[model samples]
Target chain A: MKTVKAFAPATVANVSCGFDILGFAIEGMGDIVQLNEKESPGLEVSSISGDDGKLPLDAAKNTCAVAIQAMVEDLGINPGISIQLEKGLPLGSGMGSSAASAVAALIAANEFLSSPYEKKDLLPFAIAAEKIACGAGHADNVAPSLLGGFVLIRDYHPLDVIKLNVPQDLYCTLLHPHFELKTADSRSVLREAIPLKHATIQSGNVAGLIAGLYEEDYELISRSLRDVIAEPYRAVLIPGFYEVREAVKGAGALGMGISGSGPTLFCLSKGKEKAIQIAKAAEEVYQSIGLGVDVYFSAINTDGGYVLTE
Target chain B: MKTVKAFAPATVANVSCGFDILGFAIEGMGDIVQLNEKESPGLEVSSISGDDGKLPLDAAKNTCAVAIQAMVEDLGINPGISIQLEKGLPLGSGMGSSAASAVAALIAANEFLSSPYEKKDLLPFAIAAEKIACGAGHADNVAPSLLGGFVLIRDYHPLDVIKLNVPQDLYCTLLHPHFELKTADSRSVLREAIPLKHATIQSGNVAGLIAGLYEEDYELISRSLRDVIAEPYRAVLIPGFYEVREAVKGAGALGMGISGSGPTLFCLSKGKEKAIQIAKAAEEVYQSIGLGVDVYFSAINTDGGYVLTE
Candidate 1:
């Protein structure tokens, strides 16, 4: 075998108040992308899996291809590669499946070529690929994947990335129902105008949440994570939002919010015990609704995106 | 000289994105409230300066009186005192003169009474006083003065306060143009609704700025502090905000924003040299506009409100 393959975990974007700027990489999810260094000069995508038999293998229009070419062009490495993708995450699930593919392929290619680009440098490549998937350039999913942990993109130009230390006790229980929700479509249902009062309240929560993160005060963190603006408007799209939140909140979760654009509900807890409880509660809600549930009780992935089994 | 006196600096509330929650204590640029302990009951505020006209000697009406009474009540100590108010900071200049007087009086009273109330207990008393001044309750000024650093207020119930480690290199140059803009009146001009686009973009900035604060990145901090939402609307109240920002930006300052409200512009810089330069630039701009300017260049007062002199 001329090349090896690896998987990138799915990520939850918007992580509460940080829409289009905050995201967390999840474990046990997402797609696997492969890299093959052949005698041929060009790189091509060979096979694909999961994705319900949909996603293109064009290798150019594909999100994974864009990230690979960015590395190939910059490093000037002539490795003929036929990449195969295993799209484990649902397409358009608001779980950053496309971004995972792009990031995984980029990580694999960069690692195979001896890592010519640093993690943060993957932003441009990720954004470019994400633009094709979302019709606009956004950094929410890509940044968390490439750099891992919680990242803040201060300046997209010089690429000022701040890597925040996730509190050690944070555990997330993400439940994605058997429904698909496109980020663009979900965003369209939002209000064109939000009342100033709601905005002010939301801003207070944002500040409070940041303060909570800094202090590592779990109670305050839970209280400050309340959303009065976007979640209310967007939660209407997710059928089980209310039930899942109520269930998890009763099951010893700190707080919960719609991850990214929705259908996926995420709850934070103090430990694996609480995480499992929340996950169990979430699965019950989904089961009651007669829908499939994929739940994971993983801590935040500290190392966002990197080469696996290298 | 049986009693001691000192001035607590006026503060700028809602420092950018931290509305109704964040504040910064400004030194040598607020009201001077000197307290005299008397062997009498209740509180008496007699000495008043700066304003030529009578300011009503009613103890309840006076900001210092309200703050002192609140502190005494909260501390469960009924100590008679006389507050001498020499209003150094201009009223309605968006410099939090009322808050300063309250804080200064509280500090003096607490110290004079053998310090029954600790620093942690100052926020409630200060906020109660601010309620009388602004006709509402907020701890922006009082918290910073009491905490003596950049504070993040998570919740008002349990009163979780987090003191952030502000970068040592960060300095603020405030140019106070001799003008008045009431905080209440300025707050009334906000539109009832904000576009969702603006809210999400602001969310991104909030995330980036908070993350930047933790990382202690000055450049990223400045970049993330950009306020496109509130600043645009509030700039209308302050004449030449655009001009001051442009002038200071050209002078190598990182960023500028309305300090609390209108008239006082705070430009942030990394070093003292740049701070001095920015100060000179702001002064020139104010002078060119035929407005008197008082410039103060100091670091982000990490030690907020404490016993400066005995």
Candidate 2:
């Protein structure tokens, strides 16, 4: 049997003003999936680890297996494969944990089958995995984690995804405070209707952020990275969020916002050293409140998911 | 007396997906303002023409005088300036008629004072002009007309304006039907609240448009040039709005939307010739309904307001 190991980085969705539409991948931390080719014509889960026994061992119920199943079905070729899962990212830390797993598995499976699909072609399979894990097939996390850099989901119905320009010096500090906020619960706190004025303000900020990124204007990005729609209501759900935000701003962070759906927060900075400094500042705020926190500092992941050789 | 004449191009505001925040200036059509230096202390409106006696001749009530007054007040040096207003743009045509007048007046006045401020510095005075012409002091029209390109009013509180990059081959076809839609009356049709889904969709499209413009992707721009919030309600106010849109699309227009408010519409195209074709197609729609229409074909006005040699 031939075995291939693959890795896909975790991602931050929403990116402040671009809620439900924008996301980007981070380096150094992600999920790893190992796939082994077998002679039998079916899929199976060999083992799972690093999830504290929280993930299912059943292949039919797992995110990686589900994604590979969809891919192989679409290709009309059922290759016998066994998937091994290792969760480097927390399950619901607002850091695209399931998406990373599905992406990693698909990458390894495609390599095991001698590469039949391109990187972008793997998006729909990862999105299928998201449907079962998060109850909605959103591609904000999946697209970025699959293709790398910043990704914009322009429309969901037609699945229009655009890869945006990433600034050369941009770095991110992700603070995962020890708690999980369910995506569904985070969504429930929002009102069905928002003020027309707030909507216009949010769109203006979105345009500004996109322009800022392309022009490499950090100050403009700082001014435009605001969430008028989601943060006001979701802030109360995370304790000490405002305090940490103030500390991050004081630490020379460009901008700070809740990463995806809560508990986890991201601070954008100009360089790697600044990102490290921001991470330390954020850690201190959580430590003062007697809460444990995990910190990750990374420039953007430009290569996305890739195979690894033993 | 040292006399100076200036012309400022009219602008198209609310360019499809970017309602209230995005606008671009058009070439060829504008208002002219002539300022004559006099040996007096205060401002005076000497004569007005081309308005059919509809515009006020009072220096305090006219848009041009109000803008110059604010500029002189800010400069703290009251130059005796006799203003002559020529209304080349029609009133309430949704083609930024008032903005052009204010910008042209400011350009002429600035030249009359031997240029005290940069072009961008004149935005506040133009905004003050908008307050008297319309109920609100919005800069979507004023900024573009003054800056001479696609401008994004990122935020209004501190008055942040960003001039965006324009695609070189982009052209516009503006159709002004024989009617008037007051800015206040057009605004009254909208609701104070909108669905959260609609807001997200709008922000997504705004991001797409900004990215598309920067990347020069005509197809992406076409997909993003859709207005969901205001157009649904405001479209009914324009006669044969849907019919014109369909015809414009059939003529290979990239996109079409209400320019500023109503009574005038804009269709974007790849080049000047395509714009002319789209204009003819749109004219057919209005002509079949027994409505008279005026057509203007222009590339983007890159040089906004400028002093003209008489």
Q: What is the DockQ of candidate 2?
A: 0.92
For model 2 chain B, give the 10-residue run with minimal summed lDDT: B179-188
Residue lDDT tens for model 1, A59-137: 7778888777776777766568888888888888777888888888888877777767676776788788888877877
Give the runs in model 2 whose Cα sits over 4 Å from its true position: none
Best by TM-score: 2
lDDT of each: 0.75, 0.92
The DockQ figures for the candidates are 0.53, 0.92
TM-score of chain B of each: 0.92, 0.98
Per-residue lDDT of B5-50 in model 1, one digit per residue for the tens? 7677766666666555566765456566677767887899878999
Candidate 1 structure, TM-score to reference: 0.91
